[model samples]
Target: MHTPTTTPSPVPPTNPAALLRAMFDAAVAAAQPARCLPPHLPAAPAKGRLIVIGAGKASAEMAQVAEAHYRRQGVAVEGLVITRYGHGAPCEHVEIVEASHPVPDNAGLVAAQRLRKRVTGLSADDVVVALISGGGSALLVAPDEGLTLDDKQAVHRALLASGAGIGEMNLVRRHLSALKGGRLAALCHPATVHTLLISDVPGDDPIDIASGPTVADPTTCADALATLARYRIALPDAVMARLRSGAAESVKPGDVRLAGHTCTTVAAPRASLEAAAEVARAAGITPWVLGDDLEGEARAMGTTLAGLARQTARHGHPFAAPCVLLSGGESTVTLPTDAAAAANLGRGGRNVEFLLSLGVALNSEPGVWALAADTDGIDGLEPIAGAVLHPDTLVRAWAAGLNPRTCLDRHDGHGFFQAIGDSVVTGPTLTNVNDFRAILITARP
Candidate 1:
């Protein structure tokens, strides 16, 4: 969708890489806590203690922002937040704890326990302010009763490799944890709960962000069990038994304990994409936002997008060139099932995988440039954000004696991009709005 405006046009950047990076920076900046948090914060309760608790890649930065906001108003606050290691921001009133992400670890387990204890015995006069974002399900690990930390870790590992989408994976996570699925909100019962979220999941559903630790869940243990069965993910016998017996059921919607709880989505993928569109408009490019809730196999999505880009570049069917196609959503990467394929799998996150596949499909189509990156600055588990593609990307790879198809087959996007020095690295951005993809097409002269 075009952002209607009457502002005078500025000179557009001629360099494709510079233009792409500027769009990405705008998207990430729009979702930062300092920019999105204040409007969603509730006023300090007159007769209550403000207790802050949270987890995710952005939770620490969120906590820091919340603390500063309240402190400026002279309100006393106390709490703890757990974020991915290296994603923490300094906070004085709220304690910031670093933990593992995309996978659970002992540190996250300990922090989860502390977080649970903090909310215990909170009176109706107390207020629980929860800062939730993506990656929280793993960063805030508290295995359910009768399940050990090791058991949770084992199930998590299986799920990561299962090719399941975020919705299904979070369903399983919510049922298997002590802190997720409104269980944390239940702990803060009697106290008013306020959940502020930066959504990285499709649909921007509060129930799926960080597996909805503070929001009521409509999914059941049965739903989680079905997801596991569909993905053929084997869990510990104890976990299976709990699910079958519904002993692992999450707090459902309409639960009396959650009566006064409120949830707010402060930032989302759509908003970030809109910000990028504005940047594109200023650059004299027609911006088409393809939607912010796309999901499927990453490589397949990449190939499909490549076709669209080609259509626009060659035929100008979608819109006249000098146009950029933008989209945001989480895409699944099904790890290889074959032993040989698995053994040779390369290092990369889903964004790079998508870009690599797109590059191969385009086969160096002239006047087309693209970038695919995760908004949080880290794609999957890699240190890099994503990669960029130019018309000569494949040509450069071939010149280096690298086979793009072979690399795609082995899931070696990181290797391929790195070999050609095209990987986009931004370290930790401390915010999560999910993936960002943009394809720029210039009119053939």
Candidate 2:
């Protein structure tokens, strides 16, 4: 492992950006497949043509590295993977297609259907390298028969607006998908399916990523229906019927359909968090990782974390101010007001909104700067991953003549942060391991 240079600038027992950055870097490095993919895959099968296929935020990049590794051994493979727009990697052999995410559009529908046909004729000796990641559930949308692309698109819109958790939304997605819930693996059955997964789900469950299209599902149709109901999301008549008809059950694990399968998590949020922690330690600052699989209301989570960070700075309850706090996981945003009904609403993902709320709660405490971002480098539909929040973030917003409360009330963190020039844009990191967060708390130097 390459160690970072340590500058003896005595970090005052209070402020901690350097330490936080180290932990964030470690987490990102841990989830990077460029360092993890080559060794896990078996040699290409002898009797059948190697076929690669997958869908996710990282599928395109995973495919590229997987293909490169095999080709380096003088092996050739042909396949296709669908990734979110602008998430494509440079590919020589495998075809990479970009599509809409969080919702299935015409492009995703076509790409997914095409992927289905590409793997339909595989034989026992053939090998299929399936790359699955966080956004695959929506990106690989092949709704069952009689369901139009619009139908799936409608349900996706509802799910997004519903603030349904990842697990809930994915359960509905698997039921709606023709290629999810092990249907893809079933199609590729008799052909050994080796999956390279970069887990974005809370627990890194293969079945949760992309709705387990290429892995056995542990969720059932009832669970999908219950999730939709729990959120009070109104599904279209056709979608509700599809659920009630009982024809959309996902294949459970231990099913014979997956007798010759393997799903390996080459990377995940935990790996990224640990990686970032190592960076902090090397920087001569202590790192206290809160957790990697945190999930809850974004604003609430922000308040909770901000309190801990403040406590760390003051009481040293969790850790001293000289240490950094890091964590990873997906957070939810429940539409609180009637703003969506009143207007087009604002920009920014859950992470950005969380920071906005946190900044307001922190109230410009000195010597603190924090960054929170989605590792995929895209937050919501925006090209920006997330943003940073310094003690002066709110002050700067006011200086720019922006109303922070109004923005937060309207769920417009992107607009507010952008006005303050705090938005962090790192387009398409070519990987997804959920959200990565670093909070630095330090005393006055």
Best candidate according to TM-score: 1
- What is candidate 2's lDDT per residue for 165-191, written digit by digit as tens? 788888888888899989999998788
Name the lDDT value of residue 227 in candidate 2: 88
Task: Please list the residue runs of candidate 1 whose C-alpha ends up more than 4 Å from where it truly belongs after superposition.
Answer: 1-13
Off by over 4 Å in 2: 1-10, 13-26, 336-344
Instruction: Give the winner by lDDT.
Output: 1
Q: Write the per-residue lDDT of candidate 1 for residues 1-445, one digit (tens) a residue.
A: 4444533243334897889999999999999999999998998999989999999999999999999999999999999999999998998889999988788999999999999999999999999899999999999899998898888888878888888999899999999899899999999999999999999999999989999999989989888988998998888999998889888888888999999888999999999999998888888877888889889988999999999988887897865677788999988888877798889988878888899999999999998899999988888778889999988999999999999999988888889999999999998999999999998888442
Clashes of 1: 0
Q: How accurate is candidate 2 locally (lDDT)?
A: 0.80
lDDT score, candidate 2, position 192: 92
What TM-score does each of the candidates earn?
0.97, 0.94
Superposed on all Cα atoms, the candidates' RMSDs to the truth, in angstroms, are 1.8, 3.2
How much is the lDDT of residue 384 in candidate 1?
88
